[model samples]
Target: MIKKLLLGLLALLLCATAYLLLWPVPIQAQVWVAPPAPGYVGPHAPNTRLAGLQMISLGAEEGPEHVAMGPDGWLYTAVGSGKLLRMKPDGSELAVWAQTGGRVLGFDFDAQGRMIAADAMRGLLAISPSGEVSLLTDHVGDSPILYADAVVVAQSGEMFFTDASTRFGAKALGSTFEASVLDILEQSSTGRVLAYNPATRQTRLMAQGLSFANGIALSSDQSQLFVAETGRYRVWRISTAATGLDVRQASPQAQVLLDNLPGYPDNLMRGLNGKIWMGLVKPRNPKIDNMAGKPWLRELTLRLPRSTWPVPKAYGHVVAFSEQGQILADLQDPSGAYPEATAVTETPERLYVHSLHAPALGWRPNDLK
Candidate 1:
């Protein structure tokens, strides 16, 4: 009986080894050199500024991942439920604005006062003030946008937005969060930026080859564009004039502004006083950095149980930077009372912070000095 059992155990071990080595995983991991993590220092030192966030109940809704001030003066946020929740800046009179039927990671008001949204599942959309949602463009030329992310509307009625990853479609992958994990692990850098012209009803590719392009904000004069590349932990500035361009290629019009951030950067929004705010959803995981060059290991990791995955712990952190790449503000809550800080919406009196999976909206008095 002992000999039989030993042979069975050996057979099981061999099968497990083969599965780990040769499983048909979703990602085709690419080898890359990860930048050394910059521990919280300099302008990114740890602080409790984001702690004690006054919570605003979303009732049964959760994950206010993107918050923005509507043209009509109410604060609006897109929840995981595909419902846009709107309320007073003080978190009162909460009401549903419009159900986009897709996850809107970012949105902005266009010249016509329409909400231009980058919906992860539905593609780019234009939502009228009266709550009617219309599809704008899901494909540019022969290629379809897989993950529509942050968007910024120009005064000329042109819309610039990010297609977060071409290989990982949010609709097919079950959720944006899950697709993002696969894309980042793959490191194929298929993310790109595109421009949509409402007049011509055409979408044009702007740039490409980003690991996971996330947030986007246009410069004051709308001459420059800032983008957050999440997996690489950096923000980039690309000129609006560049079309059909590869950001990976060195060019005067494109450059990295903030390099080697301490955490994974998410949404980017223009803030008060010429500042642009970015949130770090999770701190860097050393294990991930270590595996950056190990393509096979990443594939093997996928064969393991998800509970053994090296996902980092939650930490509330946000930073503000100038177009010149100067660190203007850094807020952190180490306790993570408010998790997955994705971005911030600033009003005169309240600083509304957005989270990816928090149960409610978080805010604090605009009392920062």
Candidate 2:
């Protein structure tokens, strides 16, 4: 009986090993070397500046991913519940501005004072002043806009946005978080940048081959578009007039503005004095980077318990940089009290911090000139 039990135990161990090593998974893992992440020092050193961030609660509606100001000066933000909310700058008179019935990850206003939104489930949308929601465009070529992450309306009535992934669209994959994980694990570079022309009512691809395109911002002169490619930890600058460009290749007109950021870059908001504010959602994980060259290992990791996945620990961080890619200031809270500091919107009086998973919007008094 003891001999039989030992043989059964060995068989079980072999089965477990086989399951871990040969299980079919969703991700098509790739091999690419990830740069070493720099430690938090200098301007990124630990500080309490963001520790005491004041909050404007959303009750059960959480995850203020992106915050914007309307032409009317009211504060606008998109929450996780597929609701667009508006509140006074002082956090008074909180009310629903519009309901898109789909999660809006990012949004911006057009020259005509219309609220243009990048809805992860609904594609590009234009929300009127009276709270009417309209779908702008959803498909490019034969492919639909899978994960519309961010939108920026240009002065010419044109719209530019980022499709975060093609392989695991939010509609097919069920959730942005799950889709992102698959895309990052695969690293197939299926993400792309696109543009919509209002007059023509047509959407066309601008650039392709990004791992996971996230935040977007127009240059001060409105001539260039700065995109945050999160999966690869870089920011790309592309010309508005350029079409069908590949960001991975060397080009003078379109190239990486910031490369190998220490953390996962989230959103881009134009701030004071020609500076663009960028949020770093989480610090880099060396273990994940080390596995970049080992595709099989990455696949095996996905087969493990989901909790064993190498998701980076939460660390509150944000930075400001110029169009030339010069990092101006870096703010950090290593304790991660604020949670997923995804972007920063600057007003003359304050700097509002946006998050991807916080129950409230975090803001602090702005003294930076």
Candidate 3:
């Protein structure tokens, strides 16, 4: 009986090994060296500045991912339920504005007061004042725009946005968070920035080859774009005139403003003064960085139990930087009462913090209330 049990155990071990090595995962893991982590030093050192953020209950709703002021002087946010919720600035008179039926990760008001949305599952959409949704563009040539992540309308009625990852479509892979994991782990860098002209009804590519392009904000003059390349932990400033630019290659048109960040960057929005705000969605995981050049190990990691994945700890962090890349404000909450603080929507009176999966909307007065 002891000999039989030993043989069975050996057979189980071999099967487990094979499963770990040969399982078919969504990602085709690629080998690339990740930049060394910057470990919360200098301007990014630990702080309690963002601690005890005041909350506004969404009642039954959650994940107020994108928060901003609409053209009608009302504060707006898109929850996980695909319902657009609008409330007065003081978080009063809450009402359901409209439902897109798809997640809107980022949005902006066009010159004509229409909301241009980068809908993760529904492509680029235009939502009229009466809450009617229309598809603007979802494909370029033969390929589909799988992940429309961010949108910013130009003065000339042109829209600029990001397609986070072409390989792992959010709808196809279940959720935005899940698809992002595959693309970042693979480092295939299929994300791209695109431009759409409302007049000609044309969609064209501006830049490509980003691991995961998350957020974008136009320059004051609209001459340049500040983009968050999430997987690389960097923010880039690319000229608007540069068409079909490859950010991986150093060019005068593309420059890395912030590099080797302490965490994975998320959304970018225009902040108070001449500053641009960015959110570090989650801090860097040392294990992920260590496995960056090890494609085989990365694949093996995917084979492990989901709970065993090396997900980073929640640490609320957001930064305000000048157009020149100077760090202006670094707010952090080590306790992480508000997880996944994505970015700040700054008004003259308050800084409304956005979260990817928080139960409530949080805000702090200019004086840090």
Candidate 4:
């Protein structure tokens, strides 16, 4: 009789376990639907005209995350594993500009040719052409910058960049790793954009209450700044002369540029063609977006290894959008370029791309021009 009772209990436990595994829990739903149609095609086939496409190899070990062109025509790239490299138009490497001892994300050259870098661990940095490095600001107001993602130079030489997250720094954080899962579950605003003045050598908070501000780009007229909020899957615009530093007052009323991107965008750049080029780090997963509304599920997912997690692959892609926010073209990894490209910068003679997983710059020279 005792054995029969034990069998019955085992059956009951198995049924309960099966029910728990199959039951659907109530979670917040945020669906990012695909665009009605993709605006552009992937990279051109090999031996083609190569007019509108080019890819260069930075020759780094891990991955090149961002790229910027200097006034001298040298292409500079930030390889995430603490290295910065310069390459010529023909894809020949020039020199190792500087070493940040941390992951370097975005880079831009100031009017004086000084390179301003956004380091994920070191905050904002200025590196002279001679390779002298200076630390600008580690924190804005009282909060430390957790993930300094991208930087842009204005005509006036003011430096602007995005602190992608306040809760998770870049070195330890991955796109698959969601900070909004924690923030939304806890209810707080930790993301922000910061500015540094060369004359004052001081860093100040330009705007706040951001939800994972990832990429930054200045308008063609230099009168407005556009920032990408990764978590919110939208971009917000701020006035170049916007008012008070108070979080609420400084908040620039955001305008949604592109909603429901097929993937999450990393960095943004204003191209010579007057269009915006955005890097889609990895395609968004419906399961993960659904988890954003549930704290417990998010916490569990965060604990999993990034490699073992059920996230999308980093298929490198560059999306070009018109000034009116229409996607004009889509460039893919035709040469099996970078496994995961995070940033892109267009020069007069070439298009520079930075990847996140492999240490190399992918370049496709302007054969047409």
- Two-way lDDT contest, 3 vs 4, winner: 3
Candidate numbers sorted by lDDT from highest down: 1, 3, 2, 4
- Which segments of model 4 are wrong by more than 4 Å? 1-57, 171-189, 243-252, 303-308, 333-337, 367-369
Q: In lDDT terms, how accurate is model 4?
A: 0.66
What clash count goes with each model? Answer: 0, 0, 0, 15
- Write down the lDDT of every candidate, Cα atoms only: 0.93, 0.90, 0.91, 0.66
Stretches of candidate 1 above 4 Å error?
none
Query: Tell me, what's the RMSD of every candidate?
Result: 0.9, 1.2, 1.2, 5.6
The candidate, 1 or 2, that scores higher on lDDT is 1
Q: What's the distance in Å from true for residue 366, model 4?
A: 3.7
Clashing pairs in 1: none
Stretches of candidate 2 off by over 4 Å are: none
Q: List the residue pairs that clash in candidate 2.
A: none
The true-versus-predicted C-alpha distance at residue 200 of model 4, in Å, is 2.9
- Report the lDDT tens digits of candidate 2 across residue range 260-307: 888888899999999899999988899988988999998999888988
Q: What is the TM-score ranking, best to worst?
A: 1, 3, 2, 4
Candidate with the larger TM-score of 1 and 2: 1
Candidate 4, residues 1-369, lDDT tens digits: the string is 999999999999998766545444322223233233232233312222212344455554457677777778877777655888776767686678889887677888887788888888788888888888988877766778777878898998888888866665655544323433443333234678788787887777777766667788998888778887666555667766653343334344445667656666778987877778788776556566665555555444444456765666545666777656776666665343456666567777667766676644566764322
Query: Which has the better lDDT: candidate 2, or candidate 4?
Result: 2
**What's the TM-score of every candidate structure?**
0.99, 0.97, 0.98, 0.77
